[model samples]
Target: MQLDLTTFILEVLNFLVLVWLLKRFLYKPVLSVLDARQQRIQGEMRKAAVLQEDAARLKQQYEARLADWNTEREIAKQSLEQELARERDTGMKAIQQSLADEEAKNRVRAASAIATREAELVRNATSGAYRNAAAMLRRMASPAMTLAILNILLDDLASLSEKRQEELHKAAHPENVTTMEVVAAHALEESAQRKLGDAVAKVCGKPLQATFKTDTSLIAGLRISLGESVLHANLADELGYFRSQDKNV
Candidate 1:
């Protein structure tokens, strides 16, 4: 405790100089390092937040795209199935129509062939019928050939002069008659009528009075009457009789 002012003042000056030197150099360097570290930590936190937001947005976009693709594929498959069904229906219809057309054509051809065959058969049948009838008439009429000679009797009477007309009439019968008649196809200008008449008249022994027709369908001939014998001696009936006769011969 001796009073020393010079020493005390020197110690005080030395302490002030040390504090100023540490603030200007060591203090400023330490504070700079601490500030840099704090800034780095804040920047890292902000970056992490941005990355999380970006990941969420990408996930949502991919899900929406997948849904749209699935819907498009289903629509395409439906359209293809519909097209196949339509094509099958059209093909089946075409095949059925073709079969129907062919059937119609075959029916027409079959009908034509049958008609032609029937016509040929009819024609042949008609021709053969006519020939047989004509021959039958010639055979049966042989006796009637005498009637052909009777036509010459008129000439004999004429040559004898008018006086012979009365003489021949008186010689044969009390009456001289003239008559005409129609006959059937069977008796037609055919000798059968005269031959039959001559044969029949021979029994009665009546003077032969006659005219002949190959046609015998006539209801009567020469105005002659018998007990009950009527001959079918009509004019046009000759056509049917001859048609029938021709086939057998």
Candidate 2:
């Protein structure tokens, strides 16, 4: 425990020299490595921040694009549905119209067939009635009926209008007439023929050299011919006129 000043001084000097050496070699190099590492870490952090920002922007863009695609798809789907609906409606209408036309045609055909059948039935009934009347008239024919009809004919000739008398006179003239005849279903007496000829000649304003003949087809009356004109007071002619009217109906 004696005071050793010289030794203490040397110890102090050595300690100080060691400290300087450590600071210059170890501490300086270690400090440089730490600073470099710190700068590299800071640069990496800055790059990571930029990458994160870019990723966020890309995500936003993708989301927006996806939304636009969904909207377009919905619009396309709606348009297709609307088009199909219109086509379906048009097709249904067309089918309905065609069915209506066919039904109308069938109705028209049915009406026409019914009308034809009714007309045919009417024609058949009328023809049968005419045939019955004609048969009855043929059975009723007799000489007395013929005489009565001839008398009636003479009365009609006597009662003719002045104009009709003049027409008969012109038609029965010798130059115009080719043949004049009195036809009957029965034979007449000479007195009756003479009386009829005189009456006819009086109407014609001249003598009519009329020839008389019997024709059973006349049925029950007289037929007087003057040129193209023929006057009949006969059952057969009356029946024929009625039949012609029926046929026209």
Each candidate structure's TM-score, on Cα atoms with residue i matched to residue i, is 0.33, 0.59
Task: List the pairs of residues colliding in candidate 2.
Answer: none
Clashes of 1: 26
- Each model's backbone clash number: 26, 0
144-175: candidate 2 lDDT, tens digit per residue: 88888988878988999999998888788767
Q: Which segments of candidate 2 are over 4 A away from where they belong? A: 1-116, 174-178
Question: Candidate 1: where are CA atoms >4 Å away?
Answer: 1-48, 94-187, 190-249
Error of 1 at 233 (Å): 13
lDDT of each: 0.50, 0.82
Question: lDDT score, residue 93, model 1?
Answer: 76
Q: Model 1: per-residue lDDT, tens digit, 1-249?
A: 786899889878877887788877888778777777777776776777777677777777777888887788788778877887788778777777777777777777777777666555544666544445434544444423324333332233235544544443443343433222323333324454554454434433354555544333322222233322232222223445564564444
Best TM-score goes to which candidate?
2
